[model samples]
Target: MTPRWTATGLSQDLPKGVVMAGHWQGHDLAVWRSATGRLQAWNDRCPHRGMRLSHGFVRGETLACIYHGWVYGAEGGCKHIPAHPALTPPATITVTAFACVEQDGVIWVAPADMAGSPPAVSGVQPLRSVSLTCDLAAVLAVEPALLGQDILRGTVQIDGQGHDVCLLVQNNPAGLTLHALCGVRANKVAASHWVENLRRRAEMKVAA
Candidate 1:
């Protein structure tokens, strides 16, 4: 399959020093933000002992594996080994890292060798992210208009006014997760309610 920058979550959802598990295409990924507010993405597996990096903690500019406390730098190289604090980790001790970026209120991740930047969107702010127990096709089946490679645009009506909303979708094994963004003139409450309704409809389709 062709690789592209996939939206993972809203920028506000991932604060500094936070780590979470994510998936892109078919690969399990570890997504985290350093103390300095930079986004990092890895294969979610530590080089040593094969522990999951997503279960690890972020300290300063490095991520420490919870199993053995082996710390890896932003470049995915092991920087510190707690068991051997006095010994420098070998240069070969490293984990696979990917390209990560945050723009337009969304966190994007791509393959390590993928080129180009995340698709751009303007004039909208992220309201929230929600997970649906369905595939991307089912999500589009609900409204059809909300179909796009990166950001999907649709309308939500509130107080008799049609407001524009954006949906940034990320496909995973469990289902499809989306970040909801609202236009400056959009109704936040209505947009949120619309998301809930969409989830129910899409998931209902998946179940049937």
Candidate 2:
């Protein structure tokens, strides 16, 4: 809530021309990437009829609401109204836009106005993202310092050895969501299962 950048997801999770539902600091967001690979985040509600924009589709550089077909450009301004082909929507008819950027394969957003870049992680290749039915504190308690902050570094035991792992935590309504990045030579299957195990442990901690 202090206007700091927070991780929404891993970049690879959102391919070109895709819109994903994201949450930051209690605000619901519609995070989309244009066909040209430009990333943009906006309030999930449409200016027209208050439609959920995350249910909308992406066409070229614009996001179109499924209900009214109101097309919004990267700047979040309405570019076209299907009901009125010749009329250009006023500037006031725009979705609330947010600051978005990609760093270290993570898509981060600033719900409020902010200038700095998102936290960066080095030497970690994004493996996957998983949601846990527990709070951030629960996950942090499981791994402590290794997975406690914005950027986490630790090791997961695989085949009797340790593999380096990095985790980016996102607070969501469902609880804590984690974007995992593993070392180059790490076994993905092992890393994935390790994440599931962590989730179970964290959730158990919450239940206990």
Candidate 3:
């Protein structure tokens, strides 16, 4: 029904040392890949002038603000300020960072420290990501068992065609974000077409 990166579509996204604008729940996120290929998530807003950190560049393990050039480490601590090169950045000059983990190529972000692990979707490789205008319930209404859970929670699916789909059911602040995956043997072209079809159908179903 839907594909959230935490479920399946993560590994296919930007690689290490890359930054992308992503959203979770309803919060704007600065999703970055560190030099070591580790994933980091931060509030997209830069502390200096409230610029979007996602638009910023990734230098080594840090993400630099595009506007004022404030550089932040993977832990979200301010490391350097371009305007005042000699001054040590105050420890307080840090963006609110989320705890992000990349396991089996899927990146997961938690607002606070997560006591337990994210939901399971092993044995599937990433395909791609998508967004929709539908909610989790709307998606589940169409395919209840798609979630594999008793409740209509967010779902992760391995399609009959062997493609892995990670459906992220977000609130309508900006609709939904879906991530799809496939087994190593899955056909990339077919998975892409299938995902696109699902995206259009899901968006239309909820929109109507």
Candidate 4:
């Protein structure tokens, strides 16, 4: 099967030394950036005890599980086991990792064997992400101009001006999320308000 990249989050949102929960094609992911700025996406569950690795903390170049402080290093291999300090963790104790990359201020994830780079969105800046209680159809119903399946692109009226906007779609269990981006020269505050307004309108349509 061909590999597809899913926009998981914005690059600025997942700074170094932080971890966040992400999803891709129904699989929950623990996406993190090491202290040195290495990006990684792994199965949310720790191999040792099934603890959500998203809750784990980053220590330098490794991710340590919050449950038992088991440290996973490069390629998701278990490097250290806090309980048995002297014992070297076997390679079998490894977390499942996916292909994670940051491009055009967006974080994209796919299966580990994914090959190509993520789609590019030039001349735009990252806006805030908003979760709507409705699906993509509701969004399109509200803004008929937006087009595309994964990366919705179009111009939105902001402050009486037409501003190019991009909404990266993320399908959540609850509904969905739109990781927004606006024209680089657009008024950020006004663009943000437009995003919220779009969410309200789309969700209200769903409710109706």
Computed on alpha carbons, the lDDT of every model, listed in order, comes to 0.86, 0.87, 0.68, 0.92
lDDT of 4 by residue, 1-208 (tens): 3459999999989999999999888889999999989999999999998999999999999999999999999699999998899999887898999999999999999998888788999989999889888999999999998999889999879999999999999888988888999999899999999999999999999899
Model 2, range 1-208, lDDT digits (tens) per residue?
A: 4677888888999999999999888889999999999999999999999989999999999999999899999899999999999997899998999999998889999954787778778887988999988977787788764755676788767656788888887888878688899988888888888889889999999899
Best by lDDT: 4
Candidate closer to the true structure by TM-score (higher is better), 1 or 4:
4
TM-score of each: 0.93, 0.93, 0.80, 0.96
- Name the candidate, 1 or 3, with the larger TM-score value: 1
* True-vs-predicted CA distance for residue 118, candidate 3, Å: 1.6
Give the backbone clash total of model 4: 0
Residues 43-73, candidate 3: write the lDDT tens digits: 8899998999989999998899989888998
Q: What's model 4's TM-score?
A: 0.96
CA lDDT for candidate 3: 0.68
lDDT of 1 by residue, 39-111 (tens): 8999988888888899999999999999989999989999999889899989999899988988998888898
